[model samples]
Target: MSEGKTGAPHEGPFLLSQLVEWIDREHRNEPGRIIGNLLDALRRSPYYGPLVAAAEKTHRSPTERLRALPLLDRDTFYRHSPPLSNDILTGPMADAYVYASGGTTGQPKFALYSNEEYKIATDVLGFIYSTAGLEAEDVVGNIFLAGNLWTSFNVAGRALENIGCLNMPIGGATSYDMMIKFLQAFNANALVGLPSVIIKLAEEVERSGSNVRIRKILYGGEHLRAPTVEFLRRTLGCELVRSAGYACVDTGPIGYQCTHLGGSLHHVLEGYQFVEIVNPETGAVRNDGEPGEIVSTNLTRLLMPVVRYKTGDLGRWVEMDECACGFSGKTFELLGRCDDLLVIGGINLLPSDVASGLALLPVSQNFQVVARTKNSRDLLVLRLEASRPLSDAQVLEGLEHGSYKLAKAIKDGWLNVEIEWLAPGGLPRSVRTGKIKTVLDERHG
Candidate 1:
């Protein structure tokens, strides 16, 4: 089925949409039935008993009644919930596979997936790759970190295998030299990994003056910025750089990019999950295209079903006409995470936005944003790691009139940006993730 020319949801020929419909057909539009079932299931679990009882107090139909249920944050669901076991599972949990989320620190919470959930996850990835221009004979490199409870590499590898592509499971931790050797030796044509990791690898390729055979790349695990996109295009000689999809260990298969605009938008998995954008301050639902916090409810994940779970990411619903690439579902544009947002002089700033603004100027690939409180006032430090220091005249000239325009122009004078020039290796890397800490918030200390 094809989507309508209007913004209404339409049937599509993609396997992922079909699988979603097959798994939970009724829950796609009329989520009340699933909400009722979820309530009934939650009543049987000690951890969710209070939540269910609270919902039961409302003397309304389960569908209409559940809408008033209080939102559940990570602290309530993972930290404060009563001891949980198989009681949360809608079905038997004997065959379920457990995976933990890659939280920055502290105790990691576990998410359970049944046999069918696993299959659906990989199937979604396969559909995403096929949609993002993956060919059958493509040699794919799975550079996402694996082991230590990480799921991206294994999940991506299975997807590549499912689509009958030649894939090498070279985890993200692999050294630059070894990764390059593997890519060259195996003739990798496509790569999938975190954007930061991919950029580091590309930097190595450029430094070594080697011509790698890779052309296509798909980035996930974090926000993909325009500057990074330009860097990849220049260093890796990539033409097709798209988002692998929007997903996490907590919520599987959020959405994927269609071929229409590449990574500008993502086709929300309408049949599989309910996505909502709510005002961060007031908690009111925002209209289509209004920026707000992204809240997701998983329709297919029966085991440990997440209802109105706060994803902590910022994004908004968008209505599009029939996509030229063929998928007929509504789409969402992902803004950066809520926690990563910086408030400078009453203005909200995203690291990705800063990077994109800098992409307009003549800057290097290496840059970082440091937020600090000076004299009880918020200050933003923009660190640019140029090969050599630029003269005051050059910096002033670029800031005034550049291709993308300067950061101050983009900020509209709500905030002032202080530029700091750094040599290579000037910025520090995160000890845990081995990636650059692009946004450093020092005001919280």
Candidate 2:
């Protein structure tokens, strides 16, 4: 059956819109329908009783019903990351293709994908591109990370196909020669990658004096500062397209924000997945606009049903108000990881704030904000992965300077700090998974 647009909800299970329709189709607004079904599901499903009764007594709204469920951090999810039985087949895991996720060890989240689910993810993605007014003939070069566990290249390529356009998955981590060749050979019209990666590639492309012109640049997987965006826009001679794919190995591609001209992402397909945020400390549900952990409940996938899988990330809704894009749904901006917080003298400091300060100074390409214990107290080590060559002495000196800079940038300066510079290949990649661990809590303090 014909469904809806990219920004609008589609009519199918495992899609958020379909879930909403299912709720409404059951006459959810009849005051008792929601609660009634809650009780029924509780009795029917082995995992439903406690949830249903709790909803009956406590669920104040749909959001609350979702929130009351348990919240899991990265640790808990990893425990059950690889399913051993069919009882957990709630979403696409039943008949889905499994891919490795990001991890340094051989252990990483097993990503699942169903063809039906993937199609919607692609369709919604296409609709988002259409909002940007991309024509069918637009020849776009996807600069996203590709292959095995990193699903961006494949995902974006599929979306472009669904949108009925030309796509070249040039991918990330390629040699400068290969990247230039692919873009030029394809006569690429658009570019995509991390904002920093884009900047690096743009510089290389110009320095190499390659005769190529890209029309649009889409950046994601990390924050893009306004100044950086403006620089790319001026230097690359293309409209900067800021887009993010809400997909992980565990949840697949969820929802994406349309009208990427800088606004909160519309949770386009909530029916395919259930989304919620909660205060990690109290495990209490946070109201809209409050920063909390991002969790997902997969609505599709018969192989595995993910319930309240904690993403260990934090962000907030733009506002309780409606989206200006004319789409009625929740939209949010990713703040950073939930554990990015640091406790000092019982005070908390978010690593993101520190990272932003470091970004201002062009200190490192990536970092590991590690927490360790020495003696009785805790110590914070800033192991920055430097982008350029440096001597051992120079590296030590840079660490000192970085610590001083961090102290100046953040309050409670002079906190325990150890800075190390790892060579380009020193930091291990997620063994088989494509995910990267930005920070490691080694001390458990």
Candidate 3:
């Protein structure tokens, strides 16, 4: 457990005074031994004391220090040739888990992280549990995917157990019927699963007759559509805590979610590290609301110091607004990977933005923005998931309506691509991994 006691940042930009108050209150009850250990770690980190102390020397608040930090992209991490300056991780090179995100590679890339880095990331995940109202007495029903050596299921399950909470790891791999039986038989109260999968479960319960009494649901690896939250709340009788968890074999788990207007994921644990969001080209910090690449400096890493390490993710800071969750931090949403972009009529587009818009429509369950090239021209295609199939005329009319709105929003005629709506479970699903790749670019041009 971290010696420092802290809680979630309230939604939106944090005032300096508010940040200080939260900082003081959070650490008030913490044991001195924990603080000493953390301080010792910081002291050992050549970069940590200097960076944070400089901010303090300038009389800057935590937020101000964060603002001074820069963002990074996938290219930068590779160019830097190292994630961190300090060797925070330990293990033979062949033993670490390498997870990649993006780079010169045309696909979502991956890299490896030392085993110790994975442990540290998992250690901090308990903070997410506390935010979601997980108690020691609550037996958590984990529905996150399993099968691959991927870390979500194992890391999360271990974290919950580390906190001394009993966990029921029955989900994702099992069918909906088997999952429900596990949940009911165990009398589980807390639920953690992929956002979309849980919503599908909610729909099954709504259509069929099954009594489920869940108190809280903590999920990630899937974007939480507004309707999914409503469905989970209404059907399962639970408060849905949707979070964007950041963990890579290379970078380790870092960010979590803040249910606020500012953004979806707040890099709250940054006090333990430095977080940045930079323009991919200029390498300069992006202005608030303009998305850019994300980077970080993990403080606990010794064998590997992730200093200015690019995460290949892009997002923007929340402009002047208090979050509904009342956490004060520089929160931002995960826009998508740098490679998850599609070019339409010579314009750059993100699948995440389109998905966010479609999320406003309850029928559009899951979607993929598939782009192909023919005769040196980019063709945009959309594959959407729905509960039922639409007739040709109905599809045409729906496309007309959606295109008009999308064209106006994206300001490009080609932004509204061809829409192919399929019935539920029609879309390709990643059964082993939690994340479903909705945007696919198959253009060799």
Candidate 4:
């Protein structure tokens, strides 16, 4: 066990004040010491025993030790030859809770968390909600998708409750009329869920001419485009449409958005986890400001030690002081996932770039990027919903200048581009999570 500054074994309740103090505290550890500690703890787990055993031979120097240790990709991290059992757990299984990943990427697997780990995760989540302007007396409507093994709704509920807020667990699967009724009945001052769900609810409110007062919203589960934020702000009468946090079922809380407005960057929770950006193909760590895949080491969870686990998302490590939020910790900006990248004729493009381009145009909040291979060439289709009616010629004219950056790429023959407009409810949606399929790469399929 690690000792605190007073030399006392640092283990206690997960109080918000203490967590905030820890995050704001001025403490630094030697780089080598950090790696040593990580290696020591991970070796205790049966799942990492083989990997760490081979790594012990290269502990002569810190640089050599880190480089010698192989990167734990998802296959090696989550999939075992004989499969993991309770023996892989570092602590007693009875005292820990097991939450599962939704398996959108692959087969669902459980992540074990000790009592202390769960407390710490929820506490950090509460701090994130507080930072996003959730008041003590605010009635928060938790609309994150919830069911068997779903973590979002339960996580947000626990966090909001920890902060002494009245939480209404109106799940995302609820009907629009019922959701509206619950919001009005509880006077939900804060909303939390997927961005697409909230935007859809806002549209429903406008269509039904119902009066609902949602002061601010914290949404995640996907990227919140600037255009969607603007639409939510105007439709729901909310000033803040901030991200809930950069989190997933596999990792409880990656990071949260800073209080800074008009920025998409998330403040890194370095105190909780160690995150590094590395070249996805080479597994070599990247320098600051260089974009790469995010590999995280969970310093908090011991029951299932997730050290140097690849998260598949692409991002860059940025300086904290660059943020206007006055937060003093390293932060990062997520640039879509590694798998979400589209390679066309030796050119790389991200779906987020398409979304950003669409934001510049006077289009609706929702859109999707579809890529298909035809005649040995990549064809890019952009499906957007216009808030108001626009002729095909007018839409083409707007795209040529409204989002000149995207237009230039198309004009330069980087890829063939086509635009299609969808009616109000034309786009397909996942009813379970209330999120639109952002990318449809049919070329691979």
Candidate maximizing lDDT: 4
| Residue 24, candidate 3: C-alpha displacement in angstroms | 7.5
For candidate 2, what is the TM-score? 0.72
Cα-based lDDT for every prediction: 0.71, 0.57, 0.59, 0.72
Q: Is candidate 2 or candidate 4 better by lDDT?
A: 4
Candidate with more favorable, higher lDDT: 2 or 3: 3
Ranking by TM-score: 4, 1, 2, 3
Local lDDT at 304 for model 2: 42
| Alpha-carbon RMSD of each model | 5.5, 5.7, 7.6, 4.1
Higher-lDDT candidate of 1 and 3? 1
- Cα error, residue 185 of model 4, in Å, equals 1.7
Those runs of model 4 whose alpha carbons end farther than 4 Å from true positions after fitting are 1-14, 24-38, 60-68, 81-88, 320-326, 345-347, 360-364, 384-395, 412-414, 419-434
Model 3 stretches with alpha carbons more than 4 Å out: 1-119, 162-166, 213-215, 234-237, 258-267, 319-329, 345-349, 356-364, 373-378, 392-416, 421-423, 430-434
Best candidate according to TM-score = 4
Task: Give the higher-TM-score candidate: 3 or 4.
Answer: 4
* TM-score comparison, 1 vs 3, better candidate: 1
TM-score of 1: 0.83
Model 4, residue 376: distance off in Å is: 3.6
Per-residue alpha-carbon lDDT of candidate 4 for residues 1-445, written as tens digits (9 for 90 to 100) = 0122321113544556566667655224444554566667667777776777777775675435545666677666566411365545565666766676544643566776777677778878988888777878888898888885667888888888767888899998899889999999878888999777787788888888988968889987887766667667777888877878788766678888757734568887765667788999888889768889987776666667776778888899776555676666677888877777777644576665565545556566677878888677778787877557666555555555545555666678666767787887678775444567777788877
Per-residue alpha-carbon lDDT of model 2 for 364-420, expressed as tens digits?
445567777766666677666555644544544444454454454333543466567
A best-first ranking of the candidates according to their lDDT comes to: 4, 1, 3, 2
